[model samples]
Target chain A: MRFISQTSSDGVTEQLFTLPATSGDIPGVLWTPDGATGTRPLILVGHGGGQHKQAPGVVAQAHRLVTECGFAVAAVDAPAHGGRPRSTEHDRLIGEMRGRMQAGGDVAPVLAELHALIAGQSVPEWRAVVTALQELDHVGAGPVGYRGLSLGCALGVPFVAAEPRVRAAVLGLHGAETSAEAAARITVPVEFLVQWDDELVPRATSLALFEALGSTEKTLHANPGRHGAVPEFELDSAVRFFTRHLS
Target chain B: MRFISQTSSDGVTEQLFTLPATSGDIPGVLWTPDGATGTRPLILVGHGGGQHKQAPGVVAQAHRLVTECGFAVAAVDAPAHGGRPRSTEHDRLIGEMRGRMQAGGDVAPVLAELHALIAGQSVPEWRAVVTALQELDHVGAGPVGYRGLSLGCALGVPFVAAEPRVRAAVLGLHGAETSAEAAARITVPVEFLVQWDDELVPRATSLALFEALGSTEKTLHANPGRHGAVPEFELDSAVRFFTRHLS
Candidate 1:
């Protein structure tokens, strides 16, 4: 599919490229917003659980960030989602999502030291995703960030904290299957947008994470809505949070 | 599964009961509330597409109506949903609801018989659903109103417009699929909780129904939310809405 082009406020254009999956030759779109400031701030977006990266709502927002916000957004089409290899096991897998439940997320894995695909999150891979993002910022134009919705939100925080290059993050409509291990590791500036009333993800677990984040700079944008919510985007709040920290 | 129990203001205790479908049975629930002033306004809560009535969220809301706020709520598990019949052919026909595609939400049939559900809607089963609600209401209480979420919200309004006992309605998180159809046949008081910023249900379509409702008494309780919403339970706005209309 053709990843549409968008125009940013800085008078340059944004281009959609593909990040071929390392596991397989699957192709996922990576939207590169041009005209980024000197030392570009990278923003890598991720997919929600049980959904692909190009799901309509996610795509709309990706387009908006590239076009309206002028941010370099690498929207990952993770394994088993978007253009990556299909996950044969999820449909038949055991109940609930856990690290043990299923796998396939955009991360730099180190063990293989082989092709980027087939890599595990063996410390090195995590560093690689962050390293690549930082390099891209210098190549693309400075302060890089990360954000995700739903499952993406669940993974984005830890990934951001692990990779020092990611200055901040905006996690939206997330809270399902939160990892306390991941929670403890999140020491960077972070914000959570949760539909506390949503049933898709356990709200209590998210509240627990909110309280547990190591950073005193944490904030929670609670939308009194349901799951998979697009209506309560809280764009201004998110933009403000990112701008305050990223700048 | 178990239904929730609640106590009313006048010290009346009631149990929420679901009508089971035993091969030849109609499935529904009678959720009794307290402080009946001679006759209390009853609300027939409808389930969304391809979902059972007794799902955890539905059951919890039934409790809220019965216990927290005083309103008699009767929810039905529609055919092919909940403890209802399922056919391989019908299941295939229901289509998959994932990533912005839900099967069988068309309103062409619903508009054909603007005055009713059975003849007008594309399918006869939903009309049967309307009849089931009416029959159960008559058996359990005097008169009742209607409330539905998502697909149910789209179907319930027309059903209530035709059923006189339905004094008021709160159509949650849905709008007429087509604009021309939405323009026709609305007479009762309605509170259209239009999700002004919703991503799942496009904003334009919702605006169409809001503009079409001819009832001067109709009010719009538009929220910044999405489709998978339980209006009467989680949100304080929902509780307030029920308080004003149902009481």
Candidate 2:
């Protein structure tokens, strides 16, 4: 990965970078709390679908992890999202699927297949970013944790499932049906959040994804609201969850 | 399949029957319009998870198909649910999966594996039910169509994909991630219903399933509600869809 820019504000350093990827290059941002000397916990924050590493939610969460929780944070643009160059085929498929859905058809399989394809590409990019981070000075040597939104959950489940370095996770705002098989591979502690009345995801599917995890220690935190209405209190709870487990 | 009883009410004749199977016997209900003519469109109705063939929704839908749409309808109990004797293994797995979800772990893989196994059995049973229905005088010899609910979509996707006799389908109230490849084989017209605010299925996943269908003509009818909150008007829409395609 090559750093594109570095800026510091409010006792935190934010570095924008791009990493060579099989599909071309992956854009990302990493946040590190200022005045930190040695090893500390590293948290990966995944953004929602149609978003990127720089999305407000991702930046806010990463900022919280850095400033409040004293951790380094990293995030990457998922395929067809953010600053990453889009594939015509992917865009076409997504467009077609969305159109069909608007017309009253079931196109979930196509979306899932596309998600899996992107996830397959993203997991490696994440691994590479982590490796690049480890080479930097003043970075953490502690356990790695993950916090992902809906699209994040979709890719993060399988990514966390495959990466043994991800010791704990906070996943929510998405149903687990797409990554159920990968969920079974997650043996680490997890904090799953769900909006009881999610407009975009089904409650049973979310619960089922939680059930698919092999982790012996996992907690479900359900709140009443729509998909994007996650309570601000929950972010604090997630910070605590990672602190308790990763730190 | 052997007939157990027949009752007529509201211009519809409901027949109760049991079909021999490896698990013992599968109980089913078939609804035919009273004073029915020969060779009318036949629609196979598949119930939701945890519901019997005689569940109110299943019966009500069947009655409407028979009395209003001039179609014959049939439904059977899924293995380990309703009249079919539960397998200790199935119950144990479900219990374990549910327990894990309650503990905030992911158990979607287990549920999916179980769903696949049951779909394998249910598909054959559905085929046999159709064959048995063919021998009866009240049932029709016309084009065959399928209408499956949540669990029904889980099993029905593969069933319809494999059964060439089923010319059209109405599937939804579930995601098609588990049956994407099978969905790709369904080239007939379809009308898929989804609750935009479904608690167990995700909107994108539902759209993906619709995209996966091989059908050149498929319609999606998404209502704003929870998993079980499908509007009554959608059923009427489904009946019209099937009637236009099958009749």
Candidate 3:
């Protein structure tokens, strides 16, 4: 891992970095308390589709976790998002999804295909990110958590299922179509969110995904809203959830 | 309203009281911070089936709201519950429900019938109780919240729908079979709980009840457990929910 830039504000230190990977170097960002010296619980946030490591929502959540819970936070660009290069296959799938959505056709099949494609590469990338981040002085592996929704959740299910380092997760805004088998393998405590009137994902599929989770401690929080309109109180709940498990 | 007894412990003041009604005196209990002065948010908790105003769960929730949030909390015995007298109709319904369950028959119809019978009286009783309690110096007309599940929810659905004083509610553990129309009339913020493996209420019906609620701000919290096994964390969530809307 190589640090590219560093800045501090509101008692949180933000650092931009890159980790060498088999495909190429992966761009990422980390947040920690200003002048931190000891290891702390680390939270890895995965941004939604078309969003990057430093999306507004991701940054806000990272800051809150750092300032309120005193945890280190990190986010990495997914395979074809952020500053990463997209393959011809990525372009083809994106074009097909956009065309179908514009025609008012069901996008579930395309979404599942897109997620499967991304997860194959992103899962191992996430594992490597956890290993690299944990080795840092201020982010030593005390415990790790994951926060993701939408496209993030689509990729997160398999990652959390395969990665034992993740002790807990807050995931949702996706469906069971692509992730049910992976979700069934996850046993850590999970908080799954669902938008009751979600336009992109079918409500039944979201509920089905929650039902498919193997975690004995999973909780579903469904709010009345569209795909992007999760209520603010849920963020507070997620903070308490991670604090309970990781702290 | 007449105070029958008063006690103080752990910084929470508990008072037992009864309100005069046409049928009889409606028994109730109230909790507030010791030496509390001025009007504050009040939460009325309706105990589950077979439980009373001072049931362990009811008392624990009341004390937490009082001590932690400095809110006044109250609960009253439902019709045919606690110290209230059960009519021949109540006896018949109870007998039928128990017999159906023992014989491995579906109990939803019987339970619904029982709830309908009880709610007819309890809804008006709850309104009178709220009117009487809010007249107290410490309780005075303030934003009121309601918490109830199972039979309490069956009764609460209609009560909260009709009582404009109730600004918010946490209700679940029953189904829409008997309360869908009433639920559609409730417009306040609500937190609905669902026990994923509930033995008494079918999961689909619980989801249907949540779906039937007309509140734009309603949220559903589903945990992996049976009807009687709501996790302790939900109580904490409820406290925050009331505090957010009330205070």
Candidate 4:
């Protein structure tokens, strides 16, 4: 993993980290609070596409999980981004699968990556995230949780759905609409944050996705700020939401 | 440096690159439109503090820049952030200059970091970026511009302050008052993008800086997003702003 340690003028320090990608790499970093030293709730964070684990979606969560929520974090790189240096391997797989699909009507590459991710997810590569969460507890000084923004939301939903370990989940700028069918399967208590005036991703897209979630214990946060405002929320609600559900 | 990777189901690939800090480390990646290479103005990008170079800021920017202006870009890690990890390392020679108040009384750590970064800003870093832009130019590409959000804006303003290289500059969610001072020093035109509500740093603070710059060629973009929303412009004004200045 690559790391960037940032110290603000206020003397506060933050270390930005990037994870390496293999054939199916998830880019992200784990953030530990200062002086933290025990197993805490782990936040398996996912970032949007075109963004790596070190983007705001992941970085801001690093602070929220460590400081505000008192949890350890593991920010993972989403597909075709930060972790894999462009998911070239995935792209190649995609091409191969696409060719096969064209010939056999099967999404071979897509299924391969997602299934491998899911199969190994509970294990390293995928499952290693869970192990890392436990590690965060050992190193983070406490518990763990889950957080995702935009595309990261997509990854978190599925990961948490398959693994019942994640206590709470926060989805920002994305919703069940990313894959309504897939979203319906997720039973985790999730917090959906939306920016109504977002020009990039229409607000309705997120709203539709939120409505599609099968999870009954869900809360929606409406902020006037665009997708950029995810970090502004005290995130207390998310913490509380996760705390209520996770442990 | 640690590396992280992830890929999308469809076929998007990215690598989480952590550039180590030791003075000679420069890792910059360019997102050139499918096929193109020179003469296109290069867009030099800087991410926010604790954020990696190829983060959502740039991820979002790449999509927006390509869509709005048909431009190519080179995004890089700033000091102590992303691949190059380190807070500002104080050299006794420069650290002693802390006693010297060129900007204000005593020394502001932010300023110190900024100074260190600028002094050490390598030709290799800038040159690699320029090379990427040229590669884009080899094909048919549009004029190049610069844009930075948060700390990116902070570093960017000073970056373009004295350069005649860039055709225009777009800095968002930066301090308006300090920027006013910076704009006064810059020879090129600047379009400052500000959010309607930015809590991390007061919105008014940046507004005051904008009011201070008073550049005849200067323009301001007020949006409905937060500090992180700079990359997601809600209006067509950003495109218009860049066009007016680039041409």
Which candidate leads in DockQ?
Answer: 3
Deviation in Å, model 2, residue A117 alpha carbon: 41
Cα lDDT of model 4 by residue, B147-197, tens digit: 776777776665566455666777767665344566566655566666655
Q: Is candidate 2 or candidate 3 better by DockQ?
A: 3
lDDT of 2 by residue, B1-247 (tens): 7889989999999889998877568899889988876777789988888888999999989988998888899998899889677677788878987898789776667778889878878988988888888777767567899999788899899999988889889898777668788999989878777676687788778867876778866655555568998767557667876887787
- Better candidate number, 1 or 4, judged by TM-score: 1
What level of docking quality does candidate 2 show? Answer: incorrect
lDDT of each: 0.53, 0.82, 0.94, 0.56
Expressed as tens digits, the lDDT of each residue in A1-247 for candidate 2 is: 7999989999999999888877888888889987667777899998888888898988899889999878899998888888777788788878977997798777677778778878888888888877777666767557899999798999889889988888999987767668889999999988787776687788788878876878866656655568998877678668877887887
* TM-score of structure candidate 2: 0.50
Docking class of 1: incorrect
DockQ of model 1, rounded to 2 decimals: 0.02
Native-referenced Cα lDDT, model 3: 0.94
Quick one: ranking by TM-score, best first? 3, 2, 1, 4
Q: Judge candidate 1 at residue A216 and give its lDDT.
A: 44
Off by over 4 Å in 4: A1-247, B1-22, B87-128, B131-143, B176-181, B229-231
**Candidate number achieving the greatest lDDT relative to the actual structure:** 3
* Pairs in clash, predicted candidate 3: none
TM-score (chain B) of candidate 4: 0.68
Calculate candidate 1's fnat. 0.00
Error of 4 at A82 (Å): 62
Regarding TM-score, does 2 or 4 come out ahead? 2
Q: lDDT of candidate 2?
A: 0.82
